[model samples]
Target: MSIVDALDRVCRRLDEIRACVRWAEAIVREGGSDAERRASNEIRAASFIAACGAMEQFFRAFVEWLCGEIGQSGLRYVEIRLSLHSIASSGDFRSLQSLRERDPMFGRRMDLLNRTVSTKSCSLKVPRDELGLGGETIRPGQVSNVWAVFGLPGSGFEDLGQEVAMRVLADSRNDYAHGRVDISTFLAHPECEPSRFLDRISALEEWCFHCWSAGLEYLDSQGYRR
Candidate 1:
């Protein structure tokens, strides 16, 4: 999908999370009983988890879309950054090496050498995992790693003033998912209030928008090509 389309999907997902927050807010305003309060807290925690999921989905979709665009840009392998080429070739290179070692045949070794050379002249097609995004949470560092692969500075989000929000969203999600924090404990944080959570989520939405814009700019400027 296009970056704009990917971004729109995430924003819509966040909107749904915001609706959940509103539901929790209504419970709080009703002077909920202890059990009801607990339910509200759990709802907030679930909202946080869903928010993090939205961000992660966006990151993965954006990266895949960006890579697809790069591949279709008619940029030769040699024209892109060496880091990208290396990342794109890493899996193939490892597979070739493994095959050569298993067989210990001259032909296998020669095939490995030929594939390595051919990679330099072929069109660039980066593997998804080349960005080190192996199903981990979408934290600031992970976001930076993806940008860096496209020749952008890894600190792009930090520079754009969205790092803390991104980090909090990821860390909080992990805490809830891994049972590191209970619902009560998770809700105790100032940012965990339904309203405050929405604010943080808004910041995250801003970050995604910036990423989409920057990605389009990068492609338009031919930054992916030398």
Candidate 2:
């Protein structure tokens, strides 16, 4: 797809991710039994994986296109790839690597590409265990520095935007996974903070509204949103 088309897809994916997060939160708030809660959390996890996958694909291709258009070396590609991993683990790359161990051709290509682009000095670091339901315990000297790069005016701030979506998904799902509370009690508790699940829908709605405004600003700057 063309760069613009890809960017549009990225934005749409982010929007869907946001929607899924809201729905998952609602599921948690609506109340259900243990089996029901597990089912809901599993669905939420699947949604997160799918949305994150789309975000990663769009981000990588978009970076490559931008770098090619600007006649820049692979540094920007490296930056975008690394930044995209900020929201989750680089499981795709790891899986690819695992496959490459049995496929020499893929291994050769990945090796060459790794050298062509310097991976050092990246603003985004891969999370140690993206699959873990809670905040990972950092090993000694592990840094959790978070940063995101904005696409050129009017494209989209998808790198950070996707991260926000993932954060909510991870947080809410984690709470559900740990049996913090069933959906009914969570919803009934007026003083519950951390949103538990449904308590945070309003906040998510407000966040999305603001995000749309920011996206519009980006599009107007690019002569697209207006």
Candidate 3:
């Protein structure tokens, strides 16, 4: 999807979820059946879940495209190389050497990492784990870091509001997806601060929106076309 479409997808989902929450509140005030109220809450929760998935997919697609552009444009690879190399440490090198001494596979892995980070010939198709952040799955939080690693400036990614909210939303999404949390937890309690939950989610959505914009601007600045 184009950048505008991707952003619209997130915004639309948020709108659906806001309306869903309001519907649940209306049902409660009207003394609707318990099942009806629960269903509304579940729909709202489902909307949030889908929005998170869309945001994550948007990130993956953008990064994959940006990586391809970076590989082909020949604009930022030299800066990325210098930035990556300057951050490398002797201790890191020694650890790699130790891994190589125990198993040649580590040696090969080290060689490939060095080449991929320093060369423009490779696409950003490396595994999510290769980025070296986050636990288990790579949510939008990790994707934001990947932006800086390849595309240079991360724009507002490093902002404390953006970073913390993304991480929190990512973990909460995981819990919801894995069944550790349920819809009622968010909607059943008036004291639960549902608005605060939406605020954090809105923050994450805003970050994705900006990240998409930044990626497009980066490509434009590099003279890359779709």
Candidate 4:
């Protein structure tokens, strides 16, 4: 699909996540079963996790698409695309002297890196998630790296209060998705913050909106719009 199509897909997915959260808000405010877990686990929290995952996947694809647009095969690896894209996204006025500050072992063609319209058979390796997120998939740094590299304005995932909310939602999502123990084990550490679940619905909404807007804005600035 075209980059435009990819952007539309991300927008639509965000809309769906938002709609799901709104429906969740209008549902029975409290319950204990899976269907009733909207107050805690079901659509409210689980869907947020799904939204986060979807956003990461979209950004990965966008990076690859950008690499290909710049005449490289987008197939080596994630960092391969992201690192190259980061360098490419910067302006030609960016000096190699400054770049050397970030890389003590800078031993490449300075002119090629500074050339505005040139392709290269060279690149540097960076931390795999450095261009978008921290170790936590849904934390403060989410897509901020991408935003900076692309010269996009403002915060990405940290746009709202989601830096904290995303963490809370992600951790709770882990427990709900993984920690299905027996009632005896559960009773020992009964997760009893139903109110937090309701609050997370709003958090998840902010996260989804931020991801969509920041992601689309970055892509659009890069010449992909729909």
Best by TM-score: 1
TM-score of candidate 2 relative to the true fold: 0.34
Rank all candidate structures by their TM-score, best first, as comma-separated numbers.
1, 3, 4, 2
Winner by lDDT between candidate 3 and candidate 1: 1
Best prediction by lDDT:
1
Of the pair 1 and 4, which is ahead by TM-score? Answer: 1
lDDT of each: 0.74, 0.43, 0.58, 0.50
- Model 4: weakest 10-residue lDDT segment is 72-81
Per-residue lDDT over 136-226 for candidate 3, one digit per residue giving the tens place of the 0 to 100 score: 4445446655654554455546466766666665666666678886656654443224576667667777777677767767777763311
- Which whole-number lDDT from 0 to 100 does residue 192 have in model 4? 21
State the lDDT of candidate 4 residue by residue for 1-226, as single tens digits. Answer: 5555666666677677667665665564543466564343356545646666655555555555544543333322222334344454343323454554544324344544343233434333334444553334544454555555545547665545566666665555456556554323432332223344445545555555555565556545643211
Looking at candidate 1, the ten consecutive residues that score lowest on lDDT are 112-121
TM-score of each: 0.83, 0.34, 0.65, 0.45
In candidate 4, position 190 carries an lDDT of 26
Model 4: CA > 4 A from native:
29-41, 72-138, 147-169, 180-226
Question: Per-residue alpha-carbon lDDT of model 1 for 4-82, expressed as tens digits?
Answer: 7888899999999999889888989989888987777888889878888888778878887777888887665656766
Report how far residue 130 has shifted in candidate 1, in Å: 4.7
**Model 3 residue 58 lDDT score:** 63
Clashing pairs in 1: none
